[model samples]
Structures are given as structure tokens and as C-alpha cells.
Target chain A: MGRYFLSKLIQSLVLLFGVLFLVFMMVRVTGDPAALMLSRNASPEQLEALREEMGFNDPALVQFKHYITGAILGDFGNSLHFKTPALPLVLERLPATVQLASVGMLMAIIIGIPIGLVGGFTPGSVVDSIGRFLALIGQSVPNFWLGLMMILFLGVRLGWFPTFGRDSWNSVVMPAFVLGLPVMGQLVRLTRSAVLEIRGEDFIRTAHSKGLEPRTIYLKHVLRNVAIPLVSVIGVQFGYMLGGSIYIEAIFAWPGMGGLLAQSIGWRDFPLIQAIAVFTSLIVLLLNLLTDLAYSIIDPRIRYGR
Target chain B: MSIILQVKDLVTKFYTLDGVVNAVNGVSFELNEGETLAIVGESGSGKSVTMMSLLGLIPMPPGKIESGSASFNSEEGLCDLLQLSPEEMRDIRGGQIGFVFQDPISTLNPILTIGEQISETLIRHKGLSKEQAREQTIKLLSQVGIPDPELRYKAYPFQFSGGMRQRVVIAIAIACTPKIIIADEPTTALDVTVQAQIIELFKELRDALGVAVIWITHDLGVVAGIAERVLVMYGGRPVEIAQVMDIYKDPKHPYTLGLLRALPSLEAKESKRLKSIKGTPPDLLIPFKHCPFASRCDYAFDRCWEEIPPLISVGEQHQAACFFDLEEGGPRHD
Candidate 1:
């Protein structure tokens, strides 16, 4: 187990570094950092001074080496637009993004799994049909459109909750729901299929033949078997939620990393963009690692080396 | 001996897109107490379906029992297993009658421990506490002849070998001391030597616990080793039912005779190659108006095609669904 953990950790590090390199290259390839930093009307002398200060004058390899070494020490320079350390700027919004993602994931699991189980257990039932209908809308209808609908219905007309900004608990609900709906849809389908597949298994018949209560058979026997794929979908959905929340935050004015990201990209804030991308990649890689570990724990048949 | 369980006119069918598939049609038999009854048939012969339908293990919707009544004498009273509520059936399923299905690898839950799987029945049917169930689980595991019971109790299904896994499945089946065990080809997936061992285990359990067993398999060899009475199913119905010795010594039905001929017997001297029954079994989608075995039977005549032959008593404790009078004509060749 320790060896498995170590190998996974190493793989994550390599992935993190690879992502960092790609993001760094992308920021550089797009446009000049100095040109974005200084105003369009700035004098050539001022632009030159800024470029020298930011190490744009150095060789590309040297600049990359400097950037990576500093990143290793948790230094990502300062955001040109905000005039604050990029790492700290991203960290300040991390909790809010984490909160939105976590709530979205929690809601997806709570709502989606039961629907999946029901739909899967009885494929042609009313509950299954309803679940499939909802999932269809969830998957096909864009989240941006859903966010707008929620805003128009719940926020603007109904006055049930505040429309924009992360002021109260009410604000998180709309954005979180919009983000969770698509994930929940995917989860419903996945869970249903997984359940359907598991239901056909001989072990299920064995459980039934054991005279176990339906509740025990469903939860302990069936659900436990369904958990591995369920957890993986959750992990993948979390990463997707993180990436997809940018538009959601913009629509709802939720002051999360997504908002930070949009503003940084618009302003061409190189350091801030790089920091956020690296952090997001690290988190995604870590989540995948955790998912692999969870598989071994959930199903004893799955061992690391053997 | 008194009958432990008696099934009559149990008709199970599968609804497919094209048409309804008649899996098991009007199958009926008796399982006597403390006796081993083997239901023998080739693949798709409804042997497994008959056993699964008896336990209510067949999933509804696609698969349904059109008509049937299985009367099992439980401690509460004699009740038709087919008519009992799901809750009542639950009490009888693992408690009164245990089932060991084919493919032990698929039969055992991959995630749960052997102890947990065995204790599940003990807790539910026997009402044993967790601690007592664990102790009994260890005993059951050892009873199945696993080398180290304590160590194996915590082991998963994948950790055990094929024969060992079947043994664990057997352990779970016999856990609550069920009156009758319905084993559907339990040893079919095992190696030859292991098959013998599983057969031996079944006999030992039957003798020790005095529990009647309904062992379902296509292998006549395994049946000869374990079962006393043999049920030969052909095309979703029982074509012949007789004692083990009678099935071998003086086979009556053409299908049963074909099965015996197909077996590679050590006593045979002339023929180097084993005799195989000519032609395939009939498709079960269409209704069987005549004998199901008519097309495949060498002795099939004009009467065989016109009407379904009922199982008539040919001798004491022997029955065959054949129109021909084999007594005077003797065995016919193609």
C-alpha cells in the first residue's frame, strides 16, 4: 500500500510539472507580458524597463528555470492588474471555489445516486423514466442557459433568492445547482448503468437467496458494489465542476476562483493565470490519485501490485 | 420417505422482443427428505431455470413464472413457495432452502469476506448474533475443508482457487442448516479432481446434516457419484425421471439412453469413440404439441409427432414421456 501511494504521488508530481510547463508556454506564446502590463500609450523606455525587471530580457530557458524554481518556493510573482502576489490572490479565492465544488459534488451524489439506483433497478418504471428525462435536460441544456433560467425564475421573478454576488448562503445555491446539474445528470446515467449491470450478476441472486432484507441487499450488497464507479465519476465531475464554474461564477457573481480566472484572462495577467492553472491541475491530479486509492479500499479484489 | 418439497406444473417463460421463449414448460418433480435428486440436462435444457425458478431467483419482467406451485414443508406449515409473499419467501429462501448456483467466481461477491457472506444467512435466517455467526462461519469454512479457517474467514473470493471458491460457496449454502440445497451445476466449472471433491463434499454434507439436496448438472458422471434419483430434462420439460441405478442399468427414454451412451464408460470395449445423440434439441419458442424429444429420438414414429406424450409409469418408481412401448421392442437403432 505504501509503495502504491509512493508511485501515485510520483505520477502526480510528473503530471503537475507537465501541466505547469504547458500553461507557462501557453501564457508566453499568446502575447508579451510586458506589453500587457504597460498601457498601450506607454513610452518605449518604460516598456523596456518593465520587460528587464520581469526577466523577459533573459533567455527563454533561463526565464523558465527561474519561474519553476520560484514556483517551487510558492512564489508566482505579482498579478499585473491586481498588483498582488499571484499565489496569494489565487489562494484567497480557493476556499470559495472549493466550497462551490464541494457543495456541487455533495448535491450531485445525494440527488443523482438514488435516482440512478432506482432507474437502474427498474429500468422501465416511472421513476426511471423521470430520471432519464431530467438527465437528458441536464446533459443537453447548457449550464449557462440553466443559470440564466434559474436567475430569471428564482432570482428575478420569484424573489426566492438573491440573483448575484456571494453575500449570503442563498447566492451559493443558484450557482452550485447550475454547476451540479450536469454532473448529477452524468452521475444518474452512470449509476443507473452500473446498477443495471450489477443487478444481473449472480452475487445479487445469491444475496436474494440468502433471505437478506431488501434494504440490506440494496444498500450493503448492491450499493457497495456500485461505489467504485460512482466514486470515480464523482472525482471526474469535481474536476469538471471546477473548470465549468468559471461561467457560473460570472453569471451569479460568485467571488470564487472562476471569477478570478475570467478577470485574469481578460487582463492577460500571466502570473495569475499560470498560478491558477498549476493549482487546478495539481488538485485534479490529486483527486485522480485519491480515486485510485479508493478503488483498492472499496473492492478488495483490486490490489496495487498484484 | 416423506417428501420435503414437491413442485408441479412450474412453467417459466422469457419475454423477448421477437417472441416469448419457453424456458421451462410444465416441469414437475419431488425432492424427498435426506435424498439427493439430480436434475440432468444439456445447456439451454432449462435445468438451471427449473432450480432458479424454484428459489424465486429468476428476475421478473423478461422472465416470469406463468404457472406453478412448489409446496415446501417448513416449520411454520406446508405452504406453496410460489404463493408466499416476498417477506415470507425471504424467511424460507436461505433459512429453509439454500441454493448454490453455477460459477462460484460470479456467485460469491468479490468485495465481501467469506465470513461476512456466510454470517449473512446465519444472522438473517438462524437469528444468530454477529459474534456467534462469526464462530459458526469459521466452523463452516473448516467444514468445507479449507486448510486454515481463521485465516480464510477474512479472505476475499478472489483469494481462493476455483475448487476452494466452490467450497466456500458450499459453506455459505450449508451455513444455516437449510433443509434442502438447490445446487445448479456447482462443480461444472471446477477441474476433474476438484469436481470429485465437490461431489464428495455434497454427499458428506447430505449424510451429516440429513438435508435433502437437489443437485442440477448435465454431467451424468457427477450424478452417478452423488445423486440417488435422477431427473432428465429435454427442451424445457422432464422427459424421464428414475432412480440412479435404473437410469444407468436399464435406461428407458431415448434421450436418457442417448445421454448414457454419450458418457465415456470404462466398461465399454468395442467402440473407441463415444456415441453422440443425433441432431440438436428443438427451439423452445414454439409451443410443444408433441414430444419434445421426437426429432432427436431414434425410435420416433408417426404417433410421436401428433401429440405430447405424458410421463407414464413404466416400472416401480420410474417414469418416461415416450409413446413407444420399449418393453417388447427393446432399444431401437437409427
Candidate 2:
């Protein structure tokens, strides 16, 4: 177990470095940061001073080395737009994004799993038909469009909920649903199919032959067996939720890292963008790691190097 | 001997896009207390389906029991199994009739430990408390000849070998001390040596507990060795029914004669080519108007083509479903 954990840690470090290199190269490859920073009407001397200050005058390798070392020492440069420490600014927005993703995931699991269970157990039933219909809608409808629809229906016309801005718990509802619905739909379908496949397995029949109630058989044997694959989907969905939340956050005015990152990208704030990119990658990687650890808990064979 | 379970003209059918396919057609049998009745058949011969239908294990909608009755004598009275509600069927399933399936690895849940699987049955059917169930589980495991039962109880299905996994399956099946145990090809997945061991285990359980066992298999040798009486099925219908020794010695039906001839016996002086049954079993679709075995039977005639033969008595305890009498000579092919 210790050796496994060490190997996983090394793999994570390599992934971190890979993300950093890709972000650095791709962000620079698009356009010159110096050109973006300097105003169109700026004097030549002023532009030159700003370029030198920002390390554009240095060799690319040398600048990369300095950036890596400084980042390691917890010294990401100040954001050009926010005029604040880039790391602090990113961290400040981290909680809100985490909260949104967490709530979205919670909603997906809470609602989607039961729907999937019912759908799978009774394939041709009305519940299954409804589940499939909802799943189709969820998969086809884009997140931004769903957000707009929720705002138009619930916020504008019905006046049942707030349209935009994260002011209270009630405000988180629309954005979370908009972000989570697609994921929930996907999960429901995945879970339904997984459970259906599991139900056909001989072990499930054995469980039934044991005189176990249908609900008990479902909860204890069927769900536990299906959870391994479901966990992987959940992990991937979680990362997508973090990354995909930007559109919903922007539309709903949610104060998450997604909204903050979008604003930084619009302004071409290099430090803030880099910080947010690294932060999001780290979060996604960590979630995947946690998912790997959880596999062992779900199935003991996985713990013994499966 | 008093009959404990009786199946009368049971017809199990499956509805597909094409039409309804008769899987088990008008199958009838009876099981007395403390008897071992083997239902022998090739693959897709409805041996498994007949047993599954009795327990109401066949999934509804796609698979349904179209007609006939499965009556069991219980405390309430003679109950028709087909008439029971799903809840009532559940009560009879694990409580009275235990089932051990072919593949042990698949039969036992991969995620749950052996102890939990066995104890779950005990708790559900026997109403044992958690601690009591655990104790009973260990006892049941030990009963099935599993060594260090207490320690092995915590082990998962994948941890055990094929024979040991079958033992775990047996332990779970017998946890409630069921009156009737249906072992559907229990040893089919194991090696020859392991198969003998499992077969011996069944005999030991039957002798010790006086439980009636319905051993379903395709192996004629196994039927000869373990079964008291044998029901030979072909094309979703019973071809012959007889005492084990009688079936082996004076097999009456053409299908049974073919099955016996197919077996390579060690007692033979010279090595001879074993007879193989010619042609496949007829398809169940299009409503089998003629006898199911007539196409494959060497003794088939014009009469065999037009009518379905009813099971007729040959000896005191032997029966065959064939129009031609085999008492004159061996069966003559047209």
C-alpha cells in the first residue's frame, strides 16, 4: 500500500509538470503577452520598460526557469487586471468553484442514482421511459442554453427563483442545476446500464435466491458491484464540472473560479490565467487520485494490485 | 413414499420478436422426500428451465409459464406454485427449495465475503440474528467440508478456487436447511476429480439431512452413479423416465437408447466407436406438431410424423414417449 501510494504520488508530480509545460507553451504560442499588456497608444520607451519588467526581454528558457522556481516558492506574480497576488486571487475564488461543483455532484448522485436504479430494474416500465426521456434532454441541451432557459422560465416569468448572482443559498440553485443536469443525466444513464448489466449477473440471481428482499438485494449487492465503474464516471464528471462551470458561472454571475478565470482570460491577465489553469489541473488530478484510492475500499481485489 | 412436490403438465414459454417459443412443454414429474432425482439433458434441452420455472425464477414478460400447475405440500395445504404471488413465491423459494447454480464464481457475489453471503440467507429465511447468523454460517461452511471455516468466511469469492467456491455456494444453498435442493449442473464447471468430490458431497448431505435433491446434468455417468431415478429430456420434453439402473441397462426410448449408446463404457472388451445421436433437436417454434425426438430417432415412421406420442409404461417403474414397442428387438430405423 505504501509503495502504491509513492508511485501514485510520483505519477501526480509528472502530471503536474506536464500540465505546467503545456499551459506555459500554449499560452505564449497564441500571442505575445507584452503586446497584450501594453496599450495600443503607449509610447515606445514605456512599452520597452513594461516588457523588461515582465521578463519578455529574457530568453524563453530563462523566463520559464524563473517562473517555475518562483511558483515553487509560492510567489506567482501579481495579476495585471486585479492588481493582486495571483495565487491569493486564485485561492480566493477556489472555494466558490469547489462549492458549486460539490453541490452539483451531490445533486447528480442524489437524484440520478435512484432514477437509474428504478429505470434499470424495470426496463419497460413508465419510470424507465421517463428516465430515458429526461436523460436524452439532459444530454442534448447545452449547459448555457439550459441556464438561459432556467432563467427565462423560473427567474423571469415564474418569479419563483433568482436569475443571476450568488448572494445566498437560493442563488446557488439555478447555476448548480444548470451545471449538474447534464452530468446527472449522463450519470443516470450510465448507472442504469451498469445496474442492468449487474442484474443479469449470476451473483444477483444468487442474492435473489437467498430470499433477500428486492430492495435489499439492489442496495447491498447490485449497487456495490456497480459503484466501481460509477466512481470513475463520477471522477471524470467532477473534473468536467469544474472545467465546464465557467459558462454557467459567467451567465449566472456566480463568484466561482470559473467566472474569475473567464474575466482574466478576457483581460489577457497572464499571471491570473496561469494560476487558475494550474489550480484547476491540480484539483482534477487530486480528484482522480482520490477516486483511485476509493476503488480499493469498494473492492478488495483492487487493493491487492488489481 | 409420500410425494413432497408434484409438477403437472408444466409449460414454460418465452416470447420473442418472432413468436412464443416453448422452452419446457408439458413436463411432469414428482419428488418424494429424501430421494435424488436427476434430470439429464443436453444443452438447451429445458432441464434448467423446468427447474427454474418450478421456483418461479424465470423473469416475467419475456419468459412466462403459459399453463399447467406446480403443486407443493406445505403447512397451509397443497399450494399451486403458479398461482402464488411474487411475495409468497419468495417465501417458498429459499425457505423450502434451495438452488445451487452451475458456475460458482458467478453464483457468489464478488464484492461480499462468503460469511456475509451465507449469513444473509440465514438471517432472511431462518430469522437468525447477526451473531447467530455468523455462527450458523461458519457451521454451514464447515459442513460443506471447508477447512478453517471461520477464517475463510471473511474471504471473497475470487479468493477461493473453483471447488472451494462451489462449496461456498453449497453452504449458502443449505443455510436454511431446505427440504429440496436443486443443483443445476453443480459440477459442470469443475474438473473430473473435483466433480467427484462435489457429487460425493451431495450424497453426504442427502444421507445426513434427508433432503430431496434434483441433480440436473448432461453427464450420463454422473446420473448412473448418483441419481436414484433419472428423467431424460430432449427438445424441451421428457423422452424417458426410469430407475437409474433400469435406464442404464434397458433404456426404452430411442433418445435414451441413443444417449446410453453414446456413453463410452469401460466394461467393454474391445474398443468400438461410440454411437453419436444423428441430427439436431427440432426447433421449438412453429408449434411442434410431431414428436420432438422423431427427427433424430432411428425408429421414426409415418405415424411418428403425424402425432405427438404420450408417455407410455414399459416396465413397472420405466416409461418412454414412443409409439413403437422396443420389447420385440432393438429399435429399427425406417
Candidate 3:
């Protein structure tokens, strides 16, 4: 188990560094930071000074190493637009993004799993039909459009909640629902298929033959079996959900990392963008690793096997 | 001997998109108390379905128990198992009648520990408290002959070898001291050596606990070793049922004769190669109006195709579903 953990940790580190290198190189390849930051009419002396300050004169590897060291020390230079340390600027927005993303995920899991389970257990029932219909719209219909629709109907039309900005708990609901709907749809589909497949397995027959309560058979036996697939989907969905939330945040004007990301990209704030990308990649990699660990827990073969 | 369970004209079917599949057609048999009754047939012969139907384990949609009456003299009372409510069936299952299915690799839940699986039955059916169930579970583990019962109890199904896993499945089946234990090809998935051990384990468990067993298998060899009475199923119905000795000594039905001859017997050594029954099992979807084994039977005639051969008394405590009498070496009228 320890060996498995060590190997997984090493793999995650390699992946993290790979993302770090790609994002770092991408920011450099787009345009010279020194030139992008300065006006076109700037003198050579001024350009040289700015270039030197930004470490643009140094070799790419040396500059990357300097950036890496600075990142390690929690100093990712300063956001050009905000004139604040890029790491801190990204960190400040982390809580809001975390809150929105987690709420979106929690909502997806809590609502989606039961719907999928019911649909899987009874494929043609009314509950099953309703679940599939909702999942279809959730998956096929663009979430940004859904967000806009909510704003128009729920926010603007009826004035049930504020149209924009993260002020109260009510503000989080509309944006979070939009952000979560896609993953919920995916979960519903995945869970339904998973339950349908598991229902036919030999162990399920054994469970049934055991005279176990239907609740016990499904909740204790089938659901635990269903969990591994659900966990992996959730892990993969986290990356997409977090990535998509940027647009969702923009629509609802929720002050999360997504807004920071959009603003940073528009202003060509390399440090801020790099910090957020690195942080997001680390989280995603960590989640994938965690997903792998969860597999061993759910299945003993992995935990105890050589 | 008291008939613990008697199934009559149990017909199970599957309502598929294409058409209705007549999976098990008029399967009827009696399981005596404290005796191993082997239900023998090839794959897709509905050996498992017959037993599963009685237990109410068949899924409602697509698969359904079309018509049946399984009178079981359970601990609760003599009730038609087919008519029992799902809740009642649940109570009878794993309590009054235990079932150990084929493929232990897939039968046991991969996530749950061996101890937990066994204890689940004890707790549910036996009404044992967690503490009592755990203690009983440990005993069952040891009873099934696993080494280091205490340590092994905590291990999952994958941790055990094929033989050991089957042992765990058997342990769960017998955990509640059920009146009848239906083991559907329990040894089919194990190696030859392991198969012998499982058969031996079944014999011991049956003798010790005095639990009637319905051992379902296609292997006549295993049946000869363990079964007291043999039920030969062809297509979806029983062609013959008799004392195990009578089945081996003087087989009645042509299908049973073919099955006995197919075995690698000492008397058949001069034959060079073992005899195989010709042709596949009948297509169950079309429905059977004639003998299911007619196409494959050596004694098949015009009458064999004209109508279904119902079970008829052939000898003392013996029945065969065939128009031709092998004893007389000719066809017999109704």
C-alpha cells in the first residue's frame, strides 16, 4: 500500500511539473513579456531595463528555473494589472472559487446519483423517464445558456434572486446550478449505466438469494460496487467543472478564480495566469491520485495484491 | 422420507424484444429432506432458472416466472414458494432455503470481507446480533475448512484461491442451517482437484447439518459421487429422475443413457473414445410441443415429434419422459 502511494505520488509530481513546464513555456511562446508590457514607442534603454527586470534577457531554462524558484518561495512576481503579488492575488480568489466549485460538485453528486440509480433500477418508469429527460437537457443544452435563462427568468423576470455578483447564499445557487448541471448529467448517465450493469452481475444474484432487504441489497451491496465508477467520473468531471466555471462565474459575476482567469487572460497577466494554471493543475492531479487511492479502498485486490 | 420441497409444472419465460423465450417448460421435481438431489443438464438447460424461479430471484421485466407452484415445508410453514410475497421469499431465502450459485469468483461480493458476507445471512435470517453473528461466522469459516479462520475472516473474496472462495460461498449458503441448500454448479468454476474438494465439502455439510441439497450440475461424474437422486433436464424440462444408483446402473431416458455413456467409464475403455450425445439443445424461444430431446434421442420416432412425452413411472421410485421403453426394446402406448 505504501509502495502504491509512493508510485502514485511520483506520477502526480511528474504530471504537475509537466503542466507547469507547458504553461510556463506557453506564456513565453505567445509573446515577449517585456515587449507586451511596454508601449511600442518606448526607447531601447527603457525596453532593455524592463526586459532585464522581467528576466527576458536570460536563457529560457534559466528564466524558467528562476520562475520555478520564485513559485516555490510563494513569490510569483506581481500581477501587472493589480500590482499585487500574483500568488496572493490568485490565493485571495481561491476561497470563492473553492466554494462555488465544491457546491456545484456537491449538488451534482447529491441530486444526480439518486436520479441515476432510480433510472437504472427501473429503466422505463416515470421517475426514470423524468431523470433521463433532465439529464438530456443538462448535457446537450449549453450551461452558459442555462445560466442566462436563469438570470432572465429567475433573476430578472421574477426577481427571485440577484442577477449577478456573489453577495448572499441565494447568489451562489443560480451560478452553482449552471456550473454543476453538466457534471450532474454525466453522473446521471454514468450512474445509470453502472447500476444497470451491476444489477446483472452474479454477486447481485447472490445478494438477492441471501434474502437481504431490497434497501440493503441496493444500498449496501450494489451502491458500493457502483462507487468506483462514480469516483473516477467525479475526478475527471472536477477538471471540466472547474474549467467551465470560468464562464459560469462571468455570467453570474461570482468573484471566483474563473473571473480572475478571464481578466488575467484579457490583460495578458502572465504571472497571474501561470499561478492559477499551476494551482488548478496541481489540484486536478491530486484529485486523480486520490481517485486511484479510492480504487484500492473500494477493491481489496489493489490494496493487498503484490 | 418427507418431501421438504415439491415444485410442479414450473414454467419460466423471458419476454425479450424479439419474442418470448420459453426458458424452463414444466420443470417439476421433489427434494426429499436430508438428501442431495442433483439437477443435471447442459448449459442453458434451465437448471439454475428452475431453482431461481422458486426463490423469486428472477427479475420481473424481461424475465418472469410464468406459472409455477413450489410447495416448500419451510420453518415458517408449508407455503407455495412461487406465491410467496417478495418479502416472504426474502425471509425463506438464505433462511429456509440457501442457494450457492455458480462462479464463486462472481458470486461473492468483491468489496466485502468473507466474515461480513457470512455474518450478513446469520444476522438477517437467524436474527443473531452482530457479536453473535461474528462468532457464528467464524465457526462457519472453520466449518468450511479454511485455515486461519480468524485472519481469513477479514480477507475479501479475491484474497482466497478458487477452492477457498467456493468454500466461502458454501459457508454463506449453510450459515443459516437452511432446510434445503440449492448449489447451482458450485464446483463448475474450480479446478479438477478443487472440484473434488468442493464436492467432498458439500457431502460433509449435507451429512453433518442434515440439510437437503439440490446440487445442479451438468457433470454426471460429480452427480455420481454426491447425489442421492438424479434429475436429468433436457432443453428446459426434466426427462428423467431416479435414484442415483438406478441412473448409473439402468438409465431409463435416452438422454440420461447418453449422459451416462458420455462419462469416461471403465466399461467404455474399449470404445477408444467417449460417446457424445448428438446435436445441441432445442431452441427454447419457439415453444415445445414435442419431446425436447427428440432431435438428439436415439430412440426418437414419429410419436416423439408428434407430442411432448410426459414423465411416466418406469421402475420403483423412477420416472422417465419418453415414449419408447428401453426394457422392452420397443415403443409403449399411453
Candidate 4:
């Protein structure tokens, strides 16, 4: 187990480097940072001074070396728009995104798993039909559209919640639900199918023949078998929630990393964009590693290297 | 002899997209206390289906018991199995009739340890506490000849070999000490060596616990070794019933004779060719007024094609579903 975890750690570190390199190269090579930072009417000498001061005039290789070293040492320079430390600025926005994504995931699991269990248990019953219909509606509608609809329906029409901005606890509900609905729909469908398939396995029949209660049979035999595959989907969907939080956060005016990244992209803030991209990639890589570890823990047949 | 269980004209049908397929058509049998009854047939002969129906294990909607009456001699009285509620049936399933299925690896949960699987049955049916259940589970495991029972108790299904897994399944089946044990092709998925060991285990359990067993299999060789009374099934119908030696030595039904001839005898000379039964089993979807095996039988005649043969008595405790006289001229081919 120790050896397995060590290999996963090494893999994650390699993945981190690959993501950092891609983000660094793409940000620098695609557009001129200094040109974007300078004013539209700035003189040529002023632009040259700014470029020299920012080390943009240095050789690309030398600049890359300095950037890599600075990034490693927590010296990400100043944000062009915020005029603050780039690392602190990005870190400050991370908790909001984490909070939103975690709550969204919690909601998805709480709502989705039970629906799936009921659907799988009865299969062709009314509960299954209703679950399928709800899942279809959840999946077909866009997240932004759903967010807008919730804001209009609950926020404006009912006057029960705020339309935008994270001011109160009630403010998190709309955005989280908007972000979670589609994911929850997919989870419900996946979990139902997984449970249905597992219920047909010979082991489950054996359990039934053993005179176990239906509840015990479901919880002990069926759920454990279904959970193995559900873990991977949960991890992948959690990563997706982080990625897809941009629209929901924007609609609710929640001051999260996704929203900050969107603003940075609009202003073409190179440091902030690079930092957010690298951070998002790191989170995704970490989630995938966690998922692999969870799978191995659940089923010991899969070994990392051996 | 006291009859322990009696199944009368049990018919199981499956409602598929095409039509109603009668998987088990009007099958009947009886089991007395402490008797080893073997249901022998080829694949799709409804041997397993008929046994599953007796226990109410057949899935509903797709598969249903169309008509049947299974009576068990319980403490109350002879209770009709078909008339019992689901809850009442649940009480009888593991409490009175224990079942051991084929494919032990698939029968045991991969996530749970062998001890847990065994204890689950004990706790549910025997009402044993966790500690008591664990103690009994260890004893049961050791009873089934699992070496180092304590360590094996913690080991998961995949940790054990296939033979050990089957032993674990048997341990679970006998956990509640039910009066009857139904082993459905228990040795089919095992190796040849393991098969003999499992059969021996069943015999030992029968001798020790005095539990009646219904061993279901398609292999005639297995029935020859373990069973006392044999019921030969063909296309969802029992074509013959007799004692073990009588069925093997003086076989009556053409299907049984064909099955016995199909098996290669060890004492046969090197130059002799082994007989093989011709043609596949008849499709149950097509309605048959005559004998289901008429198309494949060598002794099929004009009368065999026009009339269905009833299970007629040939001798004391021997019955066969054939019109021809076994003593007169054997069976005449058309």
C-alpha cells in the first residue's frame, strides 16, 4: 500500500509539471503580455521600459528559466489588473470555488443516490419512470439557462432568495443547485444501471437465498458492488464541477476562482490566468489520483505497478 | 417412509417478447426424509427450473410458476408451498430448505469474508448473536474441511481457490442446519479432483446431519455415484424414474438409454466406437402433442409421433414413459 501511494505521488508530480509547462508556454507564446499590459496610447520608450522592467525583453529561454524559478519560490510577480501578489490573489478566490463545488457534490449525492436506488429496485415501476423523466429534464437543460431560470423563478418571482452575489447562506443554494442538477441526473442514471446490473449477479441471488432481509441484501451485497464503479464517476464529476463552476458562479456573482479566472481572461491578465489554469489542472490531476486510490482500496485486484 | 416434500404437476412459464415459453411443463416428484434424489437431464431440460420453482426462487414477470402445488411436511401440517405468502415463504426458504448453487466464486460475495457470508445466514435464520454466529461460522467452515479455519474466516472470496470457495458456499448452506439441501450443479464449475471432494463432502454432511439432498445435474456419471433414486428429464418432462442400479443396468426410456450409451465406458475395448445421441433437444416454443424426444429417438415409430407416452410402471419401484415392453424385445427402431 505504501509503495502504491508513492507511485501515485510521483505520477501526480509529473502531471503537475506537464500542466505547468503547457500553461506557461501557451500564455507566453500566444500573445504579448507586455503589449496587453501597456496602455493603448503609451509611447514606444515607455513600452520598452515596461518590457525591460518586466523581463519581457529578455531571451525566451532566460525568461522561461526565471519564470519557472520564480513560480517554484512563490514569487509570481504582480497581477496586471489587481496590482497585488498573484499567488495571494488566486489563493484568496480558491476557497469560494471549493465551497461551492463541495456543496454541489453533496447535494448531487444526497439527491441522486436514493433516486437511483429506488429506480433500480423497482426497474419498470412508476418511481423508475419518474426518475428517468427528471433525469432527462435535468440533463437536457443548460446550466446557465437553469441558473437564469432559478434566479427568475425563485429569486424574482417568489422573492424568496437573492438573484446575485454571495451575501447570505441562502445565496449559495441557487448556484449549487444549478451546478449540481445535471451532474446529479447523470449520477442517478449511472447508479441505477449499476445497481440493476449488480442485483442480477449470482452473489446477490445467493444472498437472497440465505434469508437475509431485503434491506440487508441491498445495503451489504448490492450497494458495495455498485459503489466500486460509482467512485470513479463521482471523482470525474467532481472535477467537472470545478471546471463547470464558471457559468454558475458568474450568474450568481459568487466570488470564486472560476469567476476570477473569467475576469482575468477578459482582461488578459497573464499571471492570474497561468496561476488559475495550473491550479485547475492540479486539482483535476489530484482528483484522478484520489479516484485511482479509492478504486484500489475498494478492490485490491488492481495494482499500480506490480 | 414419510414423505418430506411433494411437488405435483408444477408448470413454470416465462412470458417473453415472442410468446409464453414453458420452461418446466407439468413436472412432478416427491422426496422422502433422508433420501438423496437426483434430477438428471441434459442442458435446458428444466431440471434446475423445476427445483427452483419448488423454493419460490423463480423471478416473477419474466418467469412465473404458471400452475403448481408443492406440499412440505412441516411441524404445523402439510402446507401448500404455492399458497404461502412471500414472508411465510421467506421463513421456510433458508429455515427448512437450504440451497447451494453452481459457480461458487459467483455465489459468494467478493467484498465479504467467508465467515461473514456464513454468519449472515446463521444470524438471520438461527437468531444467533454476532459472537455466537462467528463461533458457529468457524465450526461450519472447519466442518466443511477448510484448513486453518480461523485465518480463512477473515479471508475474502478471491483469496480462496475455487474449491475452497465451494466449500465456503456449502458451509453457508448448512449454517442453519436445514432439513433439506438442494445442490444445483454444485460440482459443475469445479475441477475433476475438486468435484469428487465436493461430492464426498455432501455425502459426509448427509450421513452426519441426516439431511435429505436433491442433487441436480446433467451428468449421468455423477448421478450414478451419489444418488439413490434418479429422475430423468427430457424437454421439461420426466421420462423415467427408478433406483440407481435399476436405471443404469436395466434402463427403460429411450432417452435414458441414449444418455447411458452416450457416456464412454472405461472398460470398453480400444477398437469400439462410443455411441453418441443424435440431434438437439426439441424447442419448447413449439407445441408438441406427441413425445418431445420423438425427433431424436432411434425407436421413434408412427405411434410415437401420434401419441404422448405416459410414465407407465415397468416393475416394482421402476417406471418409464415408453409404450414398448422392456422384457419382450428391448426397443425396436422404426
Assess candidate 1 and give its TM-score to the true structure.
0.94
Off by over 4 Å in 3: A29-31, A293-295, B266-271
Worst ten in a row by lDDT for model 3 chain B = B265-274
Cα shift from native, residue B121, model 3 (Å): 0.6
Chain A TM-scores, candidates in order: 0.93, 0.93, 0.94, 0.93
- For all candidates in order, the CA lDDT equals 0.88, 0.86, 0.88, 0.86
* Top-scoring candidate (DockQ): 3
Task: Indicate the DockQ of the complex predicted as candidate 4.
Answer: 0.63
Clashing pairs in 3: none
Pairwise lDDT winner, candidates 3 and 4: 3
lDDT of 1 at B229: 96
Q: Which scores higher on TM-score, 2 or 3?
A: 3
lDDT per residue (tens digit) for residues B1-334 in model 4:
7899999989998888998787898888899898999999999899998987877788887899988799998656789888898778777777788889999979988877788889988888889999999999999999999999989888888888899999999998888888889999999999999999999999999889988899999888998888999999998989999999998999988889989988878887685776888999888887669989988987787778888888878878988888665556554332
lDDT of 3 by residue, B1-334 (tens): 8999999999999999989989899988898899899999998999988987888888777899888798999886799998888888899988878888889889999889989999999999878899999999999999999999989989988878889998998998999889999998898888999899899989898999999999999999988899889999988899899999999999889988898778886755365777899998788888888888889888889999999998999889999999999988899866
DockQ of each: 0.77, 0.66, 0.78, 0.63
Residues A219-276, model 4: lDDT tens digits: 9899988898889999998997775377888899999988998898898677878777
What's the interface RMS deviation of candidate 4? 1.5
> Candidate 2 on A88-178: residue-level lDDT in tens?
9888887788888888889888988889888988887999999889988888898898899899999999987899877767887888887
How far in Å is the alpha carbon of A104 misplaced in model 1?
Answer: 2.6
For residue A93, model 2's alpha carbon misses the true position, in angstroms, by 1.6
| Residue B212 displacement in candidate 1 (angstroms) | 1.6
Order the candidate numbers by DockQ, best to worst: 3, 1, 2, 4
Q: Model 1, chain B: what is the TM-score? A: 0.96
Please provide, for model 3 over A112-188, each residue's C-alpha lDDT reduced to its tens digit, 9 standing for 90 to 100: 99999999999888998899999998899988888999999999999999999888878888888888888898899
Q: Kindly provide the TM-score obtained by chain B of candidate 4 when compared with the true chain B.
A: 0.96
